[model samples]
Target chain A: MELYHRIQIQDVVRLDHAALDAVEAGFRALGQGRVVQPPILSMAIEESNGEVDVKTAHIRGHDRFAIKVSPGFFDNPSLGLPSLNGLMIVFSAKTGLVEAVLFDEGYLTDIRTALAGAIAAKHLSRHDSRRATVIGAGVQAELQIAALKLVRDIDTVDVWARDTDRANAYAERIRERFEGLTVNVHGDMASACREADVIITTTPSKSPLLDAGHLPAGVHVTAMGSDSPEKRELEVSVMTCADVFVADTRAQSESNGELKAWAGKTMPFEVQELGPVIASGQSPRTGHDQITVCDLTGTGVQDTAIASFALKRLVA
Target chain B: MELYHRIQIQDVVRLDHAALDAVEAGFRALGQGRVVQPPILSMAIEESNGEVDVKTAHIRGHDRFAIKVSPGFFDNPSLGLPSLNGLMIVFSAKTGLVEAVLFDEGYLTDIRTALAGAIAAKHLSRHDSRRATVIGAGVQAELQIAALKLVRDIDTVDVWARDTDRANAYAERIRERFEGLTVNVHGDMASACREADVIITTTPSKSPLLDAGHLPAGVHVTAMGSDSPEKRELEVSVMTCADVFVADTRAQSESNGELKAWAGKTMPFEVQELGPVIASGQSPRTGHDQITVCDLTGTGVQDTAIASFALKRLVA
Candidate 1:
């Protein structure tokens, strides 16, 4: 007899530090060349203003893997529906029988994405970092900061948005969530990153938002908003000025992330991957005066990792 | 405010002639260049002899599309489990919201594949064809013969299998299904095609089973088994002898079907697609003695079409 399990969003919302660690381990395995991840299968539904992407990865010696179907329809919001929704289908790697279906409705994607941001901060940001800057006032802005709290002692936050009212509202929510932390709303991106130990960009802008002049010495920048070819968060000059630059996956970074501006051009510095840094137990940012940048375009390894983690927790 | 409907195998078993017609229309659309189908995403799990394939297609101007995940574990039968299992997820094209999930196992695949064979026979075979020859006594052998009855007046079946006992048993089942129809078990493939109007091969042999010498004049052959690079059901000589050669898709046929034998080699004929032939309302087989061959490698449009058809019936 065959058995199937369906895990809903409520079950997945309870993820914690353990889930973050699981995703980090997936990155480590990928850096060690122990995972098989294929190029994403993307299809455009032009009439509906929608796109669907199928992603999967197999970790060597792992008992299970996941195939995630993620679809985004830009017109969904007008119909009173969320723009992003889909599920992850998990199968036993040994027998290929479906072990479970995570009907997360994009919750797991949010969790894994935020956790990836935290993973980058943990390996590149200063250990005693207490001030952080967020470049967007959306759902991801809050989640990315919350995830960073797991790895650092962040006690102050600087928020910046294209609209002042949205930024102020975002600051109020942050103050309510973190009692003793100070939340300051900034009018410009330059002011928000001037004095912060870690800066994160979470906007879906088609043009570059942050440049080299916006960065401060000894700061770590995590660009999490650009995950498509049309999106860019950091300028090419910013990447070139940084002492060290890392990517979640070099191929994805060059195609869809902040590094896209420098895609076919050669650079003076060697590009490092986040997975190898975590696996090797070394921080690329060795001094307090060195600038470091990490570009995350997401990977299938993270989906398989997070799905496996959620299944274990829900089943238990 | 999200709703999900699950249609099980029991619900899909009620499919009738309308479902077959819906799939035929999908082929017609594909032939007219009104469908956008991405290449299939396939992954192999070597340890368990398992492979997973993700197929999807968007029909122009349709309200919804489908993404089907099909997994095959060859070793499952040893553990008393079915060798194939998976589901189809359908999303609304207007809003990209998942409208339904069809947990029909592999029933939808079986339905679409069998209907594709019927569609090929409908457009390529002689209008008065009455006798059919099936080269393998598998589930598809029974389904193909049954589906062909929708377009032709098939009253007699010649069953051939590697094992004579299985062929005899298959003949018995066909006799019970269609009263007053003559069914014969043949020991060799040549004898089965000696006096038949339509021939269908449904086996997983890693070799050539039928050659030009096995085919008689005016016979239409539908090879539905060789869906992988290592599998072949017909020899190159048979294709060279046919007056018209049709493929479900030229790319897939060249890689995983009987056409693989002619890959990288120049052929005397241009390969036609089944969809265009049906849409043009013209049969390439001009004379009663012309030999026609169709290699059915399957396509994502069939999955989307059949899933949409099943959802309409189940909801009504």
Candidate 2:
């Protein structure tokens, strides 16, 4: 089997129009019930304070699919190594032969995840939106803004992080990359999101950081972190108050994202998945003053979609 | 990072004592409650008449773990390709970094599976055994006999299959391989198993093939092929009649093995996993006339164990 390194993959996969469309198509297939996705196969290695997740999906009729293996060793940063590293194995959906081994090392995941946030904003946020308030100053915090630009004319970013230095550093780097774009570092999350058209939570915070009072009117919020049972970025009131509550997948949202606060209780209102909502082509955001929230804990279909897209570009 | 092809893996891994012991140690860890194994993540591609299974386990304190991806495209044989092909990814338990990739293409799984049957017989079968009966003239039917030789003094074989020519062919091959061993191709299932000291059912039959009447006194029956919901090889009476009933893992067995026969209902006897039996250093087969049965549904720890062992030999 052919093995492609991170450099090769980085050259091919991007948080651009084609990649976003590919991922959106995956959600469309998933919404149409043409995708075969199993529950995430997760293993915890307590001795190392690490976790690994194996995810796969087969979009019916698609010629190719992908299985993603992602590992996160939290202690790696302490050892001067990156905390997350992994790869994707793309395969022929018809014959099960491997198409390629993409040692992208989680690059595709980062792109796909950021794109998912953009997807939610595209369908739920106001069309004339121009500013994004990003929580956390990580790689995702930067990529989320870049991806949001594909769907909306985003030219400004408000950054908030627990670490002021990291937030300021993020502002400097993003401003350099996105020329002439406005960048502001906020000391408080409420102020960061006070006048934003869209809000994105990209922190690994284990407590609720964003709530109804912090959300601006007509703002579309994408909580892209909080993918574990212990992590929660949005308070229950935020979900309860949103005019449109979207989950990437309800099962995953309930298990890992903002919806965990209402895990067993009956939902106060109808909750729709981002897939079916996008597939319907009818925006749930019918009014400009609506609060839209999407809990994107991530899904296997995104991995499969991004990997398939990566292979197409690499082979081309 | 290092990808080892089938030949490279074959050169290092074998169905021998060390390999068997490694696999056994995995089960020992499992039985000792020192292993973290999740349920198999399975996906089916109906368009291709194919299925894929992803399995992995973390043996606490072990330096490494393995995630195995196995694919079976049943229609491949119709296209003149082998029906099974896949690989294993071995990672560092400490840092979650890629150590090696075993592109064994299901070779390691075959060895680990066959060795699991041998492990069962070694712990549950009578020690003073010489003759054997293996139903189904498939790859496993042949490997079971070769693996059985590691723990028993097998000198005679009784084979039964739906295909007469294939059964006769298997008889010819094992005769040449075992060198002067008596080989008998039986016309019926009952007679094939009547006088055997060890009776192994290795077919993908959706219905039961072995029953109480077919089991000889002191015979140890290892049903190794029923690893799916619709597959069964032994009748309920056979399990009830056996002095001890064993499963590789009760959860897997309940979902995809002989234990599926009693999936919802409680079994008539105490069912133990082969691992605990080995770890305890006590055979449930106390009497020579005792009929012991083991359901070998396979496990993630076996894959982790075998792949870790394979890497050790390759790096050496």
Candidate 3:
């Protein structure tokens, strides 16, 4: 029966340390087999060049669970509208009654997604990681860097985009946000990845945008763009060449992430998941020179976790 | 968003002719390939013995579409709570923006489900059908009869339930509701179905409850229960014995309805969908003695159609 708007939700929940811990706990619970998440339900409106996805999950002991309705209208920008917007409904896990509806317009998804990227870096990236590179000049690019600051000592940042002007704009925004941090716009992706201790791919590209040659030694990559079957950011070799590869969930990675490229083929490496890695308290990085990559197709557990956290903050 | 509760929604949308027409038009649009519906998104909370399903569809030209979240906590009734309840979110098809939040607590689902049964009867049943035998003495049994009265002259009724006391109570309620209508409580399934012009199965029975021998000659059977994979009402022989079998949607029927029992086996007859039957302007009932059966595994299109209809009524 409670309703919170986008501004109210944004005021209460942020990509801060507490939020990161909450999201990490969700992954830990998922790894411990205490989370019940089902495959996402997505519908396409071809007439409007739109897609809407519904995702929900219940963590065993949470007082409430969340069902997120996400709508992405690709063609809406032509009419001067935001491309992505939707809300989340949280219900009591006990009585299955509505507790709150967060009309966040996708803000919480952005926060939780950024936190997942940072969580991957925290567990997979080199401990002293300082330089980070982000592909895609969208809101997530900025949010990812902000979240990474909580997990790693990321001081210098590199920006890469299909559009050079957007990349420069992204660098300018990052420079203004972080007081003494260094931000540079890279004209080419290869130069951007040259010194990156952590690389985050956040684009909506439909084809491979990152190559095996682009990743430097000891660099960790987090690809969060390809949450749908049609999108991919890492080339097949980029994932295969890494010393370790982890997915948010193996099923989604095979269907909607970089691993879909290797659909019928058996992977040469033992693919792990972020949750299990977090749960085991073992870093995927064995040595300073080991390269790691994490694929995030997103999960319902993240939605439920973030929404529950938001509700707690709102009620407080 | 505009918010309406169960009472206001029930006051606006009923088992009336106009509501049925709106739902039928949705099926027509679906049959004509103008509907965009995705497979349901379902999640189970085993700890609470609960299940949640998210269903949605966009009928191409409609101004608005609907996403319905239905939750069933089978264990809730032990604590004096209703076993099924949830809400629907209606959005603009053009802008993908939320227009209303319908806190109908599953009333809309009931109304639409009942109307779908009546719609099937209108298209597939005999024109002079005057009797309905409902297999379960639950809320749906009463709603199905109320909706069936809109299309067929269902004056005589037979009530059958595993619980005899509940069946007797259902018969009493029916007698009181329909003036001068004969209502009888049958002790067994076959005896109740013997004189039925139309038989509606509306139970949550996991195993087969209705047998092939239970159906009388030329009877049109609408099986509305068994929406989940674990539930089935009619024996496999009951479906195979029908001259023609119709489903709300073939995919749902095969996966979640009676057809899952025949998973790999080839069917003896062509299985058609109710939407296509409604669209083709043809009845599968070729002869007066032809037995017809419909598997009513509720569909996303019906939810979208009914929610859209309810939204209009509420706003008016």
RMSD of each: 2.5, 0.9, 1.5
Residue-wise C-alpha lDDT for candidate 2, range A1-316, written one tens digit per residue = 7899999999878888999999999999999898999999998998899999998999999998899999999999999988888999988888898778898878899999999999999999999999999999999999999999999998889989999999999999999999989999999988999999999999999999998999888889999989988899998888899999999999988888787898678889779999899899999998999999999988999999999899989989
| DockQ of candidate model 3 | 0.75
Off by over 4 Å in 3: none
Q: For candidate 2, what is the interface RMSD?
A: 0.6
On residues B142-217, what C-alpha lDDT tens digit does candidate 3 reach at each position? 9999999999998899989999999999999988888988998998988999998999999999999887898888
| lDDT at B304, model 2 | 98
For model 3 chain A, the run of ten residues with the poorest summed lDDT: A42-51
Give Cα distance to truth, residue B264, candidate 2, Å.
0.8
lDDT of 2 at A246: 94
Please list the residue runs of candidate 1 whose C-alpha ends up more than 4 Å from where it truly belongs after superposition. Answer: A1-8, A11-15, A262-269, B1-9, B12-15, B262-268
What's the true lDDT of residue A6 in model 2?
A: 95
Give lDDT tens digits, candidate 1, residues B94-150.
877778777667788998899999989989999999999999888898899889988
Error of 1 at A249 (Å): 2.2
Identify the candidate with maximal DockQ: 2
Q: Where in model 2 is the C-alpha error above 4 Å? A: none
B-chain TM-score of model 1: 0.96
